[model samples]
Target: MFNSIGIPGLIIILVIILILFGPSKLPKLGRSIGESMKNFKDSTKDIMDDDEINQDEKATKENK
Candidate 1:
């Protein structure tokens, strides 16, 4: 169902949020979202790196 919401739907949603929150709050909201996204990305990267390190260790031990 969510996949059906295309560009037009997103624009409408943004417009509604703008109306509800007012222009003054948008910056704060955007900043909060940006920070959250950054944290999520950083954590994901860390998890991926850990997985790679574990896989490398497993391969090395198996070879030895």
Candidate 2:
């Protein structure tokens, strides 16, 4: 989707966001977005780890 949105496109989007949200709100908005991204990343990692553990358990049982 964003494959075509290069540096200029990103700059334009940022400018628009700044205009809409203003400088003061930008920091708060950025912090919230960062936190959300971190949470999403952690959740995905936990899910992947669970899948690996389950696969390992299945393999061990099959070997026995």
Candidate 3:
């Protein structure tokens, strides 16, 4: 979907964002976005690990 938005499009979008949010808030915005992404990744990883553990337990029970 985002394949069409190449370098020029990205630059334009960045410029628009900079204009709207200004330079001063950019760092805070980036930091918040990074933190949000990290939290999302961690939660997903935990969920996947739990799913794997459940599957393993079920497999062991079936074998028994």
Every model's TM-score: 0.80, 0.83, 0.91
**TM-score, prediction 3:** 0.91
lDDT tens readout by residue for model 2, 2-47: 7899889999999999999999999999899999999999999999
Taken over the whole model, the C-alpha lDDT of each candidate is 0.98, 0.97, 0.98
**Which candidate, 2 or 3, has the higher lDDT?**
3
Cα distance off (Å), candidate 3, residue 36: 0.5
Candidate 2 vs candidate 3, TM-score winner: 3
lDDT of 1 by residue, 1-64 (tens): 8689988999999999999999999999999999999999999999999999999999999999
**C-alpha positional error of residue 5 in candidate 1 after TM-score superposition, expressed in Å:** 4.6
Go through the candidates in order and give the C-alpha RMSD of each one to the true structure.
2.4, 1.8, 1.3
Candidate 3 stretches greater than 4 Å from native? 1-3
- The number of the candidate with the highest TM-score is 3
